[model samples]
Target chain A: MEISELKITIVGLGLIGGSFSMALRELKPKKLWAVDINQDVLKMAETQGIIDRGFLKPNIPLKNSDVVIISLYPEQTVNFIKNNLNNFKRGAVITDTTGIKDKILTEINNFIRDDLEFIGGHPMAGKEAMGFEFASAEIFKGANYILTPTDKNKEENIKLIEKIVMGIGCKNLIKISPKKHDEIIAYTSQMPHILALALVNSNHIDGLGLFVGDSFRAITRVANINARLWAELLIKNKDNILGQIKSFEDSLINIKKSVMEMDSDGLRRIFEKGSDMRDILWRL
Target chain B: MEISELKITIVGLGLIGGSFSMALRELKPKKLWAVDINQDVLKMAETQGIIDRGFLKPNIPLKNSDVVIISLYPEQTVNFIKNNLNNFKRGAVITDTTGIKDKILTEINNFIRDDLEFIGGHPMAGKEAMGFEFASAEIFKGANYILTPTDKNKEENIKLIEKIVMGIGCKNLIKISPKKHDEIIAYTSQMPHILALALVNSNHIDGLGLFVGDSFRAITRVANINARLWAELLIKNKDNILGQIKSFEDSLINIKKSVMEMDSDGLRRIFEKGSDMRDILWRL
Candidate 1:
């Protein structure tokens, strides 16, 4: 089906969901509906003309949506899918914006109907803010969108999701396995969040504000995170995150030992390696 | 003496020295001189009118200036001061842009002439890039300027340095002891640099570039660092930095354990603490 002719519904009107609706509005879908527990948020999105309609419950929208994008916390997403299994239209293409995918996909696979298509997706873009009020379409601009397709997904449905991703100004569309996605995300996303949080919680002298440099500010930008949401993501991907953390601890210990022994050459070599790696990653 | 009536010479025309020259240009001192071993950098500064004159050696400029700002590696700054003990004019106010302070100040104190005042100063500002070519007066704009003054420094000399710091567009002037500066700096500056480098060097899945996000990018921005300079800074402030590293490891291990145990409430509480700390730090 053509994008403009398809009816779409976004579940949960938070930062990611609201942003999805705003970006999808530009595509001019036949109908753009939002399902959120907060009635005030529904009123706000509709008043702003970001969606054709807003539903406090998922049943009505789920029954009519040709495509449903569930943007909720990890566990909430799984439960939402389970509770609404009987409500979705036949052959409807469904996707989710969950951070961890392997377990989520496995759980859905056990109960999902044969006629429906469920694609796992993660858009690697967000602000440290929360809720529908702070959402903006610009967050997805030039973002990397990862789509994890299993055998249950049809080629045409994946193509349709790609069209929507591109319509929202995503620059890269990475297709990978669910397990691969979780492992890579543990390193790139979850580990960094943990480091930032730990750095902020570390002990420091009084009046730390007076001595902070650009490096401190940059490293701690994401320290003001969404605790509830991140707790769910981090715990759900525990093993992979633990592996990444151990690797990070090894690197940190090596550098710390060089400093303790006053090993200038060793410290210099490690720093040089870090610089070269960052340069290569950025250039790619 | 008034800032406009003072003759100022800046040693080492690297990023900090070049930027010092540019920001001081706005003050219009009696004479702005730069000293560097690299004759090409000296010629370029002179040609660009950022300095009234440039010297390949410090002998001539050091003998005449009322104020001298040494912007060099921590060890190099100490050696230059020790070697040029007799060259500085009587009662000249000298300062440095070194990252570490306690050791540098102590070494200079052993041989510094009582007739000449050497007040320790560190402009808490820099970019990942190095060298005179990347310097800009704007780097100091609204940045924090730290002054570590001992009994050897006269009240008027400290005030004079404050005037220059303000003239260079610094927003805050921090006055503390050299020992305190090093301790605080270990947390705010050196430790963050180590973490960034360690994070970049950590193991990750191949094709990691496709999964990069803002959190990773912000956390690793300082990974592309100045190896020689950072190694010197990290080792010179080794004891304090090691203390900070231990503190950070404790925090990280606590958070990691919560994830391993699947303690959702424990994870949320820790994240809340981090978020609160960050918000409070930034607000202050």
Candidate 2:
């Protein structure tokens, strides 16, 4: 089906959902509807002309939409899908913007309707701020969108979601297994977040404002994070995050040992290795 | 004593020195000179009209200038001052741009002549890239410049240095004791660099480029560091850095334990502390 002919519904009007609505509006879908718990948010999105209609409940919109993009917290997303499984339109393509995929996919696989296609998606774009007020369409301009498609999804449905991912201005479309997405995200996203939180909490000095440079600012940029959301994320992906943290701890210990022993050569070697790897990663 | 009438000479035309030269050129000093082992850098400065004269050796410029700013590696800065103790013009105000102040000031105190004033200065601004080729006057714009002044430093000389610091576009002039400077830097500057290097080294994944988001990029931006310089920095301030690393390790362990045990409340509390602290710091 052509993108313009599809009726799209975004479930949740927070940062990601609002942003998805704003970005998808540019694609000129036949009808863009949003279902959010907050009536004010729905009213605001409607007033902004980003959505054709707004529903406070999912039942009516879910039954009418051709595409549904769920953008809620991990637990809430699963509950929303489970509670309203019968409400979705027949043969609709459902996708999500949750951080983790393996658990969600596993749970959804057990009870998902055979007619509907559920493609798990994770958009690698966000800001430290939350809510619909802070949302912007440009957030996904240069982002990477990962899609975890199982055998239950048809090729045409996957292609349709890819078209929407591109329509949102994402730079890359990575298709990986649900397990692989969780593992990589544990390293690239969750572990870094934990480290940032730790770094901020480790500060014992006062009036550090005078001494900090760009390095300190950049390293701690994500330290001002969403506590509840991140706590849920960290606990949900516990095993993978723990493994990444252990690897990070080992690396920190090795570097700390070199510093303690005054081993200049060892420190130099480790730093060079890091520098080389960073250069290669960024260049690629 | 006006900035326009002062004869200024900058030694070691690397990133900091080169940038200093460019920024100071706007003040229209009586004569601005630069000295470096790399004749190409000196020639480039001369061609760009950032300096009136370029010296292969510091002897001539040091003897003629009323203000001298030394920008070199920590050890090199000390050695240059010690070797050229007699070369500086009488009553010339000498300053340096080094990361650590206490050790360098202690060494210089043992042999520094009383006729000249040597006020230690550390501009908290830099990039991962090094050398004069990458230097820009804008590097100091809105950056913090720290001045470590002791009883030996005359009030007039300190005031003069403050003018130059502000004239070069630094947002703040922080005057603190050398001991206090090093202690704060370990937590604010050195610790973040170590964390960045460790974060980069911990990445054992082969294709992280596709998976990384803005958080990972920001946290590890300093990973592409100058190894030799950072090694010297981390080792010279060994005790303070070790103390900071230990504190950070404790913080990480606490968060890790919470995640491991699935203690959502514990994780939320820790993350809230970090987030609130960061908000306060950035707001201040």
- Using all chains and alpha carbons, the TM-scores for the candidates as numbered come to 0.96, 0.94
Ten contiguous residues minimizing lDDT sum, candidate 2 chain A: A207-216
Q: What is residue A175's positional error in candidate 2, in angstroms?
A: 0.4
Candidate 1 lDDT, tens digit per residue, B79-196? 9999999889988899999988999999999988989888999998887688999999999999999999998889999999999999999999999999999999998878778898
lDDT of 2 by residue, B1-284 (tens): 78999999999889999999999999899999998999988998999999999999899999999999999988898999999999999999999998999998999888988898889999988876789988899999998899999999889999999999999999999999888888899987887778887877888776665886787788878888788988988888888899899999999999999999999999999999998987777765
Report how far residue A76 has shifted in candidate 2, in Å: 1.0
Instruction: List ranges where model 2 is wrong by over 4 Å.
Output: A47-49, B46-49
Q: Write one digit per residue (lDDT tens) for candidate 1, span A50-86.
A: 9999999788988999999999998998899899999
The first chain of model 2 has a TM-score of 0.97
| CA-based DockQ, model 1 | 0.80
